[model samples]
Target: MSPTVLPAACEVLVIGAGPAGSACARTLAQAGREVLLVDQHEFPREKVCGDGLIPDAHAALRALGVYDEVMDRAFRAQHVRCVAPRGGHVDVPGTLAVLPRRELDDIVCRAAREAGARFAAPWRFVAPLLDGERVVGARLKGPDGEHEVQARWVVLATGASVPPLVAAGVCERRAPSGVALRGYVHHPELAQTLRELQIVWHPRLSGGYGWIFPGPGGVFNVGAGLTGSHATEAGGRASMRDVNLRQMLEAFASVHAPAAELLERGELRGDWKGAPLRCSLGGARWSRPGLLVTGEAAGSTYAFSGEGIGKALETGLLAAAALLEGGDDAAVRARHEAALAGLKPRFALYEKASHVNHRPWLADLVVWRARRSPRILRRMSAVLEERQNPGRLLSWRGITKLMFE
Candidate 1:
């Protein structure tokens, strides 16, 4: 068979080439498993994101052996500067980095290919192939035509896009979650003087925040996100409402001082792009017979923060580890399900906090306090570094004492 041709079958079929899919495929391939990894777009493609890699995300990449490569090309950010409206701000220390998704996605994917996973980019997944309710593989639309491929197990990691999940009945229906808009901006300050990632708490974007992450080549990733809890209800149904995310993004920049300061002198690289963030913090169905869903397709994004990459990479590694445990199909499925369950406490806590965070004033208060008090600032840093429980921020004391005191 010619190189680049899709094989009829493999031991594992991994969809998506982003961090989650690539990581899973790399781990499986390194473990002596035949793997087929596919993505709809070619490498180095645009992915709308804040591009901020926190401690959890960095740890996952480091474990996968591609963290240093990304760091070599990324802008190293040591602290996160959280700004409240009306000029209140606090700087929390952490190990964060910014690398555009194009480069970040391609780098990890290259690692996967080097590990012996057969990769086929520019190929789209049409639907999952099923044998009496068990997924065998998926139908991939390649350059030639639609081709059916079979595998012993499938790891669905298609980030962002949800059609494949819906088509396979993996996800029946979901409520409106969150929406975000992001774009690259060219500003000389990024290279000249800017040093930290700026996270702004604004009253305009309910249950969300605006961010400015320094990037390479004099450009930085800037964006805003809004949770569905505050989005307008059209006929009282969130699914039917049309969210003008671009407008929300623009509004944030115009009001937030730090963001506006940069926008005043910098230029947006291209038109604003946006995507829907599905937060399945309430225990969405993630695994089925012969199929395990990773990444955004499984609703892995953290509520309010919209942090998915960390969770995605974590789940991807968990999926591979479960299969590597050496067991039959049923045992493998059970292991994967249990591994995923371990992450639910944090997800559930974040979900609960996100609801109370719908009150933007609370964000303003936290940011204000963090800036004024050193102890609170250190505590905030602990939360960012994952050393403290975020669920506490959702408690009654968190809502009243933390916000008011």
Candidate 2:
């Protein structure tokens, strides 16, 4: 069979119309590049997420030019409830935003379109169209027919989805090495009670926390994640859902009656979307080619917080800037790596701290200590807010002062 012919040309072709993809397309298009953004699903597509935009994410949205809309449509809050079974609580207050992925992605896509990006949603990426050794574009299969798009550059923002090129072996898909499950739920009490995001820690789900983020109307987003190693060691004898949620409720119920009741009555919104957590600070081996993978596809998520939105936005911005630098793929890659360097150590430490958190008792103790001490709570809040790195707490002086003073 004859191969499909490539489109005349374009400067950039972006796969996946999520936050990272649309951000890249918008940036490239604003720079006068002929950009084509494609996604398998149409507008208002649903994405599995906590649906809460951390404070850092709010800043990123502003830079992406949709802060106003996001603010208008999102749930405004000022604190995160950290409930750990070890028996203490930490309440850190700061401005945060929550909006369903549907609305958030739609707003970003529309902004990309308004910025001159041509979008082709409901278009499946069949494969990457390579020019010699360089990734030039992609072969897309849509309702109309199969077509090839040739471009000077390609941005793979397919998130967890394997891009055709990656699936075809031209690039490697970095497996999470850790598994996670996220879902939505609805309950009037959960909705009214959850004025802010809640993070519940249980001993059964070490290295992962169950999260409940309020959604539109009276719904809530709830989910859990656990390291694959821990999950396996837990015997693989039963399901994580039962083990984790049970642990979650036990730790949260008495202190948070509303949360407990919501769990008892709330309907799990949709099918659980399970995926692996990619904690690759070394970046992807295949990302150095003309093709670049941003967001979770590149494993840029912070292992500790599961906060990918900010890093994804930052990576997309870096990709756009690197492309504008007029350098080869290696040059673009170096810049990308350098951009993420500052965030690597903090993420690594987060992962370490997170693992120690398996003992909800320990987490509760720390939270309890923090609650009793205002200064400690302030410092901890600073760490959670990303104002101070957790690794900084490793210093002897810092550790002693935090514990004693």
Candidate 3:
């Protein structure tokens, strides 16, 4: 239920209670700060995501003190099968699991509340409350009515939703970095057969890839993503691609036999859904005077793999740490910006590797080589664990090395 009363003031006001916002609120509240966590949707609401958790996500969950709780409920997997266009595949081993965002996010949000953060839902951020250029709070609308709440610091963690960032004057690019569509299928037989997280690349879904991840019970997450849908043209204008994701999914099934069988034999549990993605940390300013942006709002998703949950949680923790440092506004902003800058180089590498999504033959080559060379397979596993730079495996230098080695 929505909170009947909204606090007039808080030490920290976190908007958008996804992984990022909830992580921030949890950290701040655990530090004894008065935190108010608000979201436009209520708890356990459905969120579109691949729901694959890798090693980084595991680390973040451990830090948040909810690792065991999440692991207990998540569908565990040992490997991710990367399939090339020609049906070649390589299994990269890692610590992996899958739990729907509806469940995963609710657990994190509940952790925040348990840490003493005041939680409220169905409260939409209307605008930023500013004293000149510094954000003082936000005007929120809920079932009760529209109301203004004050806070020393405001955090924007709204994932892929641009309006809140625009209202707060932090949005840099109006266009999303990419787009994706996904749906769940409930077939116990299919789920039992698909033990690994499967990623498929094909020319038909250029600038993106298709994934079939096994979820708890009989559900399997199936979808395709287009990372180049909003590529910026040479003339500085956004070049929008007119592509139908539903058709793309159909094409994926046509080309990939497992996907075809899944669709043909399994029962789709819900309508297919799509969501915009912000990637490579390029679409927004990380912070201003009194506001900070984290999560997909700040482009936390990786361009190559479209994974953002771990980074979103990590960025949220960074935001909370900057506030906990107890410095002047400039100092706090500087710290947060530096933290994001540290991750920029890694995001750039992923962006470089995303070229494989557009040129899928590269994936086929890599998979073929990986199947032949144990060294290449080890590097691929490192890439998934984030131990090695993705460029080391996807760049021209990497490709040349793969051929000779």
TM-score-wise, the better of 1 and 2 is: 1
Give the C-alpha lDDT of model 1. 0.79
Candidate 2: C-alpha lDDT = 0.70
What are the per-residue Cα lDDT tens digits for candidate 3 across 88-207? 999999999999999999999999999999999889999999999999999999888899999999999998998998999998888888889999998898776789999999999887
Candidates by TM-score, descending order: 3, 1, 2
Best by lDDT: 3
Estimate, for each residue in 243-284, the C-alpha lDDT of model 2 and write its tens digit.
353453444444455556766787866776766555544335
Better of 1 and 3 by lDDT: 3
Q: List the candidate 3 regions with Cα displacement exceeding 4 Å.
A: 1-4, 233-235
Off by over 4 Å in 1: 1-4, 174-176, 229-243, 281-284, 403-405
- Per-candidate TM vs. native? 0.93, 0.86, 0.98
Q: Tell me how candidate 3 scores on lDDT.
A: 0.92
Worst 10 residues of 2 by lDDT: 229-238
Candidate 3: residue 403 lDDT (0-100): 78
Off by over 4 Å in 2: 1-8, 163-165, 168-174, 228-257, 280-283, 394-405
